[model samples]
Target: MTLRSTLTTLAAATLLALLPHTAQAAEPYPDPRPITGQEIIHDPTVSRLKSGGYVAYSTGGIIGARLSEDGRHWTDAGNAFAEPPAWWYEYNDKADPWAPDLSRRDGRYWLYYSVSSWGSNHSAIGVATSRTGLPGTWTDHGKVFTSETTDTWNAIDPAIIRADGKLWMSFGSYWTGIRMVELNPKTGKAIPGAQVHHLATRPDAPYAVEGPYILKHGRHYYLFASYDACCQGVNSTYKIKVGRSTSVTGPYIDSTGKPMLEGGGDLVLEGHGRYIGTGGESVFRDRGKDVLAYHYYDAEDSGTPKLGLNTLRWTKDGWPVVL
Candidate 1:
């Protein structure tokens, strides 16, 4: 295996303990040392590269890159990937290539991102391939799935899960709910005959629910997603929610046996203290359980949206409580 694969094993050793589920929320985790070269980057996806180097990428509206040696302390921030497709700009004017999911498979790095405005159905998911996962080296594959201006939910926040030897992607929000499609391994394209499922939606959810990430525990495929507003300062209402299914294209259910397809979500994290708007999550299941990585308005400082990392533990009763 490579360095990233080795460090992924090391990260698994650092899994956090599962705790009780409470709506009142947490007492805050003690500050850990800053993982360097990762300054100002938000919405982080952590994984090991073939070079054995740890690579993390995020949506600063553009891809940001950093290297981690011990999988904790990182080196300087490196080059972000290039924006894909020439016509992607026709819809999005300001270059909001956000929320990149970096996956290393078959000796290449696949960069998937949402290219569009927020909260609108006029969004699309696109792919670009890079041999080295370096700066400006992506080979664009154009659009993967489009959810723009239709009855369909918005298509963004792409995450690829490999199961039973097939590649699948989970994406959607807005009028279009969270959904999934099978992917072609060689071309990184959706298999033409694939169908999209309406995973979850909440018209009364207080706000739009977006940002879906998947993890595995025991026999279930865990669907972890953020709900409500993401970028508000003091009034931010973001929270993490979860559901699970036996398969990736899920009719995922929550702790109450309520289906996520019907908008029932188990609360995982919410704002407390000076920290507000605590969701926009991408969960990392390093060792055993899950650890969450997202951005929040800092409680103490300027209340600026800063990077937040915490562990999500399963109670003895089998529900995830974010700490």
Candidate 2:
């Protein structure tokens, strides 16, 4: 590469960092090789452990765990939560953990995950409790939520957000739209008989929205979601979007006030270079910095989905720009 080309690339990056609304052009991020047992690591949900280090979780194929001392280079801890929990024998023929959301609350690390089956929405989201955010000592809370029928929208990809002094969960994608329900402060279970409020999507162009993560910055509540084809090798077109509302059970709308129920989204990151099908986002605020965690299939790595972490910054005018 020529020096001039390098200078051009650096200038472009600078411009992106300076601009807060539109995303910065995708560049080669920190690709720490020997990301130790991070094989096909997809559906990333990250949390900063109270005792320092970061716990990053993923689904399917071994159900792995990677610990990052500095929120970057990971030391593989092997499979943390494997499937075939005997619950699968009672339900689906196979057990696939969809997405796991990690949070520290009430002096314990609560890990909420799901179980899935192919060709059916007959699924369940489960929870596990850990005193230390490491492998071992995880107490299972089985079947947090499940589908009544195989055809109805399945409950998976759980993203728990605490708003208005209560915990809310957003779960669902195809078959039915995304909905939010309050969880009991003690057990983190949905308040009994509390009808979940519908949040986004319409009958037309449903787009199969899922992976909802909320970030409450300043006074606005931001709802970030992923839209379209996931899990399909290189043919996927998954992208992330965000909308905000004053209330947790929101009629979330885009920057233009267009309802997410109306199928409106502002794109944050998409496939670039050898990366394709970027989606499955998890957002959190840490140490005055907002972090976005998601997965992208790296063609350079033979379409293997690898975990990615990027810094998120907001505009003076209230737009979230990915750094």
Q: Which numbered prediction scores highest in TM-score against the true structure?
A: 2
What does the lDDT read for residue 150 in candidate 1?
51
RMSD in Å for model 1: 8.6
Q: Model 1 clash tally? A: 10
Model 1, global lDDT: 0.72
Per-model TM against the reference = 0.82, 0.86
Model 2 spans with C-alpha error above 4 angstroms: 1-39, 82-84, 150-152, 202-206
lDDT of 2 by residue, 1-323 (tens): 99999999999888776764634334443332234444457888878878887888887643568788777577777666544467754445556567888888889988888777764567777788889978655777776767757435667778898887888888877766677777887887877787777777655654578888887877788888888888886788887888888887887887777888888666777766666777888975568788888888887877888876778768876877666
Output the number of the lDDT-best candidate.
2
The TM-score of candidate 2 is 0.86
**lDDT for each of the candidates?**
0.72, 0.75
